[model samples]
Target: MKKLTVLFIAFIMGFSGALKADEGMWLLPLISKLNMNKMNDMGLKLSAEDIYSVNNSSLKDAVVIFGGGCTGELISDQGLLLTNHHCGYGNIQALSSVEHNYLKDGFWAKSLKEELPAEGLSVTFLKRMDDVTQKVLEGIDADTEAEERKKLIGENITAIKEEASKDNDYTVSVKSYFEGNQYFLIIYEKYNDVRFVGAPPSSIGKFGFDTDNWMWPRHTGDFSMFRVYADKDGKPAAYSEDNVPLKPKHHLPVSLKGVEQEDFAMTIGFPGSTSRYLTSWGIEERMNVVNNARIIPRGLKQDLWKEDMLASEKVNIQYASKFSRSSNYWKNSIGMNRGLEKLKVVDSKKEIEKEFTAWVSASPERKEMYSDVLSTLEKAYADRGKDLKAQSYLIECMLRGTEIIALGTRTLKLEKALEDEESDEKVKEVADGIAASLDAFYKDYSVSTDRKVFSAMLELYYKEIAKEYYPSFYNDVVIKKYKGDFNKYGEVVFNKSVFTDQKKLEAFLADPSLKLLRKDPVFIAAKSTIKLYKELYGKVAEARASEAENNRLFLKGLMKMKSDKVFYPDANFTMRLSYGKVGNYEPKDAVIYKHYTTLAGVMEKYEPGNYEFEVPERLIELYDTKDYGQYAATDGSLRVCFTTDNDITGGNSGSPVINANGELFGLAFDGNWEAMSGDIAFETQLQKCINVDIRYVLFIIDKYAGASNLINEMTLVK
Candidate 1:
């Protein structure tokens, strides 16, 4: 770790951190850094042009964005796409009940006809992209205020989208990359009405929930299956029972050949955001304060909520998604905090600052520029502290509410009704809107969610912050205000309080006789606070944007360092292509990931009593029989491949790990233990990615799952 930091420090100063100098190398800036080139003789072959030129037209056809969900890719054309099971867990859970229990039973369509249609799911592909930075940032001057700049960017994007899609079957979106300096208009064909093809039980999909999240030597089969659907004409359309299977222009072939160390591999998918370009102060704040003080504590509340849910079946059914969501972030924060700690990011930052200061002392001109840059960054970090507590509170407050989308729908109906002049028309529209909204609101939102969040918020306030910072007698006031009046807050939130045994909440909402009190003071205050928080959130977003621009300038330097060195900008949750080969890693003192896990490990980790890692009897039995056929490994596991270096993050889950021939060899699941810090700092020495070998996934589909009928649709190379 010391050497790691020292090497990084030397690189930062010696290489001048010039963006262009390392161009066309495997060492991506932030989104993903190139893995240690153990196979290429510690050399990088892929150029910036190769990376930037990769597109739908360049890669195998099987890779597709799961669309409307997290990123995923098609490993086989026969509708056998592999994605992080958690990504599809919601729909799986949504379709499951105590009777069906897909999460427990594991859904295998058995046949194409049996594949279930997921109501709101969709898949999208980026057909093309054109740089539109000039248009998006056009006419913007140094004097442009944040709010005005945002509005202008929005207006320009709208216009660009309209013009770019003039003769295409795709929808156009203008994206900001490198902050506001670079923009790309992405044209995509969105296919709605994707169906749930299959999935291993939670035991296979999410084995080891919180207990094993973000840890390596992992044995989780976090894969889900879905199939895209379209109208009979093969065009994007709304959900219909009669919708036909989508015929894609490109779908990657399953690579039975496997990925060996440093074999050329790449994943073209949407990788969410990264702030590798941020100053050391930014990383320190995330590590020491923002993520630790705020995210971790709130995450603990969710854990508590889940524990509460599991204790009661009814609560489990109601707050399942809330619990799952909370757990996800909780695990991520844990990993993030650990990475920051292990790397001693704050210490590293201080060292870098000291070195830079000393370097600046050698030259007057350099000293002035260095001072100005540090001053700018310091001011930004200082300003970020003012609203930290308030912002954290705002998230907690919203977590205890109804579906925002449903709320938006309700607001729209109310606005329309208020605008209508005709009594009958207004009545009809309002009634229909209200009736239509009932199921979406009731089914999607859990009443316990609000209870859990609100209680957690209260606890967080007390547990984390200083009492003096809070209003005088805040605790006493809350207790007094709600004393013997349980219905007050409950009625405002869920029209009733499921968290308590209060029967008066229903009476309160329905009582027309006391309608004036319906505008409860507490409810009104909550609403006003929510509105103010939202407005403040917008300002925070703008401020973050300004800081992002400064960071981009730093990154841009990396790309422009020297000619002949091409650079693929690190991912920003936009589609990116990272090419590498299958490989094992040697993390300090001979820790190695020789081969990937198989279906056997799925059963090995299963604990019948533990919901997080429990494997079902059927899956265990299948694994014991060596049912993998051709995909079976000599090492005895399912034969998933390993990689030493790749840049990926949470959003990159289910991204297709393609081979040099552009065949789908593996579905990227997670990064290795050493690479945990890759999210914050890309250490080519430490940043290795773990991918589920495509062969294992295919074997599951063809043999155990019995969905081979779908396999006929793909163009299999082997």
Candidate 2:
């Protein structure tokens, strides 16, 4: 493994080779050594240091991890941030009410005073990253036990973090790359005073909703704006009236020049997770077990939520964010399964494994290291198959599916604290914490809606999952007491559980009695479900430990075997850079996709009364008058969305699509449905990143919303 690392470094530094346009999520620091020449040749006008630099401000300074999952970019000196609307949906929903519904009507801060403070929302700037593989793996060798190696690695990582953050206000994490074949220490400075600046209404932001979520020829103006504020000393601080807008070290200049066919494009952001290194067996399990389990239950839940949402506007506002979050991945899973089968990814993985096996057999040393890797993975996945499925169902149905159960589970900690030390202050502290969370939880929660979803999910769990795998409480409470009636069980739980009523919960918390909590049906069910989940998680953990060790060896062996191939690490929500071009491809026979879509297409598809196709009156008036202002394309058409061959996944949402000159041109929000399988296997032909054109985002902000304050903050380039 050490030799392989040396060779890998040598390979990266020594080669002045051309890069393939269709693949690779390259590390930013390695850009100068490994990718600058290729990128320069492809049309990059900036130096590698211009992309990522430690000595000076660069593009890296402009990008941040938006909240927990998405990516955002600093587009103005005043910390004006740009991300996808969906990425900000939760905050938007949180701030929304029936009277002042931002989700439906949209929001634009006319001034800094109007910018709403978003509690608990944050943006983390990457301070720097260091290759810490040697430090992390110190005193570890081939003979070390997996558990011991992990402990050593954990200790080293902790020590490194402590040393790095001694006097600095930074959060540090050591992320393993290439399936633990390499490690990097990432440092981030997090700003907690994030504010909501602007967003288009859902009619435009989420135009097609579920129907066109992952599809191409997209026209959604899926962009949102936010701002980061800093304290008097220009440092991150909690929200305060005295805080000023952050003066960013580097902010992207927005380009209205627009993109063309094969125009050089790149996306810089934290892509969440990609399992491109998974074996054939892993892909099968993902498709049949994980994706299947999520898709079915979520689809059922969404259907129930949708019916309720459409029936009442208040319910619609309440459930909008939750339904969107659930349905987005549910649709993605459906598309991924289709793409996986259509692309024959499993067979392709099998072929690769055959090559890997053959390469290992060619040398005794390689055989000793990697001969058991494939077999170990096969057996581990095979042995854990039933449990894995059970775990998935358990999480989807019992934990994630039922709102009351999830809410009740929160009390377990309070119950434990009460049991251990019966102090009034401690009880009050726990009760207050629970009380603080209840408003937010119950804001979107509907008893009637959740009851229906609970019943449906429980019924599905009972019908689909094995009887033995059901939570013991289900058999004990539902079958034995309620006579196998899920509806009756749901009714009883909803009616009796304190979790169902905020007032009841508050009253109970005022008294602070563990006896009452232990007897609570919802709490009882939660305890049972959690216990079973932990037991199953333990089994899965054992399997994963063995699998991880074998996978590391396998990755190391594969790297040695295919030393010629440039191996990029699988995404783990760390910063990565992938460069490509604005181009399009055919999904199948006789169907060609263009590089971009225009507002004309949006109007063409517009049906005034239809929920998915409705266009805002102001937008329609702008289109009718051709009032595109300075944001229109050369053809006088306003480009709403475009396609790029850039590699992206879930967490890449709101990632800024940069041009050769490193100007922000688009916001990456989704992937083409035809290439949903790209996460597991990059389908160069069909895989395309769906991005909202920066011009359209500006058009909506400036023309439709008439929010000149936002336009004034941005650094626009023609």
Candidate 3:
């Protein structure tokens, strides 16, 4: 694995020892409710006063925390917003029917009146978070059962909500961290009125969907625009034609001054989660047991999906979206596992734990809990391994191509069931159930992209596993039905299977003659394979359980290692702030990255015919003309920057990259290839985050697209 050049020594020395007790202290100082001086010193150029003066008051107003899907920012007083294009792709797809494919052509509301309101879309702003560790874990002890512990925690959170709401109007949620070592009461204001404003074509936003995901040197413009809507009273309300654009309290200023090497930077958004505190045992299991058992099968599924995509257009339509998403995540796991192996993250964690355990041994009270924790974790891994395997199997087989067919059957069954049912409520329940499943079923099977992966995995399962497990379809089945040779069978069943035709299958299920084929040899073979796969999955679950228990022991040791000295939990898919300076990277002996990328480089990477690097003609023309005026390229090109030490994960997509002044400089998107494991472990040296220069965003908005009306609203700081 490549070593991180900047913070290698500091990270190696262990976070507790290498970092000051409050190295992240400069992040949130207590000088005042909104301290400008401290925030400036910490790397924000904007003062607390500036944040407040800019229509936003308090951290709550300035930092809007997107809930459920992903985090985004309110960029306009009239509630114009920005987020990852991938995040908004679903809505765009939903709006697009067969005749109007917005995803293919892109969607831009010519004016505010043309904006489309999407049902169920929401945006949440964090109003406040008070430390509630004591309140949450008041009576909890090491001996407490997991279920009892869960119940108590829930009750305490409910109580906290009741108390916090006495005079204030907000929603409260108790968040857990560091294995129950800490808790926070988060108060939020959720807005349900959000509309799709604009989006670039998927060809640009999702360029190189699988090819460039998790790999660096990326050129994806993964961004989209939305607007928050509110009633005349300025409070959140359900979507209605009468709703008006929202007036936000805070909106980030577009900074064209841009970032330079070693410049201080920070990302303030909700991070999904990480288990950097897991035990060496758990890490090893993830690296080996989990990855080996699940990731390979997933890759096989993806391959199958690709095959089907090429074979049938209908399959492409039904499964393409789902396969894209599934494969996108699958590749992350593949890279994460590979990177962990290269970085020896598991080994490093073990070494760190060795020192921690030794220190804990000095204290009698701490030593008493040590062995139990380790033993419990070991048992948990053995117990949980099967569950992990089961999940993988479920996603690959039962939930992919075949599952949707089953779903279509259920839908038809419900229609038939309702045809005879007299009770309106029961019929409604059945109809609703089918509708709910249909919504997911369409996305899940994504016939266009995912069928090949699903069917291929089924075939591989039959071929790879022990012969005893698939007796019926092992030797004679292949010989009689598929010519006995395993190689030919694999090619026919996986590489050339006709099941990839989603529309045909749907028709067959609808046709009585061919519908019975749904129960034919191929389907029966897959079903039997799934049954066995599920049993093995249970074994994997047991292993994961043991591993999780072990991780708890390891985390416990680290807590004692720090002993009363404060350190926040690693990450928990919750909002977190990581601060560091921008810097170049030496990925290898001969490869040195300058910590920035220019529009020229984007052009260099562009290949007109290649899907991975295709540049739009308009964007290329603008770049050639040097049309960027106020949003001029910072370094004489489209400025894409890199940073050395911000911890983020999947959900941090489209997070604003801000300077010490809190000025928006870029949008956080991809991480470097060497740092793929940073999703699980943040190595400051190897884990540099790649971002889209805010300048490029502005230039595209101004010169390329000619949306000056939108550009004029931003508080731009050139």
Tens-digit lDDT track of model 1 for 456-528:
5544654555543343223434446665233444444444322122233233323211223224433333434
Across 526-620, the per-residue lDDT of candidate 2 in tens digits comes to 99989999999999989988888888887777766766677788999999998889997898899998989999999988987788889999999
Q: Against the hidden reference, what TM-scores do the models get? A: 0.80, 0.98, 0.81
Best by lDDT: 2
| Whole-structure CA lDDT of model 1 | 0.59
Ranking by TM-score: 2, 3, 1
lDDT of each: 0.59, 0.90, 0.63
- Residue 286 alpha-carbon offset, candidate 2, angstroms: 0.7
**Per-residue lDDT for 669 in model 3?**
73
Which stretches in model 1 have alpha-carbon errors above 4 Å? 1-57, 75-80, 137-158, 167-169, 312-314, 350-371, 397-435, 444-453, 462-522, 538-549, 552-570, 586-590, 599-604, 635-637, 640-644
Worst 10 residues of 3 by lDDT: 1-10
Q: Can you write out model 3's per-residue Cα lDDT over 192-224, one digit (the tens) per residue?
A: 988888877666677667777765566666778
The predicted structure with the larger lDDT, 1 or 2, is: 2
User: Which stretches in model 3 have alpha-carbon errors above 4 Å?
Assistant: 1-42, 45-56, 59-62, 65-67, 97-99, 142-151, 161-170, 307-320, 360-363, 400-428, 436-454, 463-553, 563-566, 640-644
lDDT of 2 at 223: 86
- Going through the candidates in order, what is the number of backbone clashes in each? 37, 0, 69
Clashes of 2: 0
For candidate 2, give the lDDT of residue 401: 91
Give the CA lDDT, 0 to 100, for residue 87 in model 1: 83
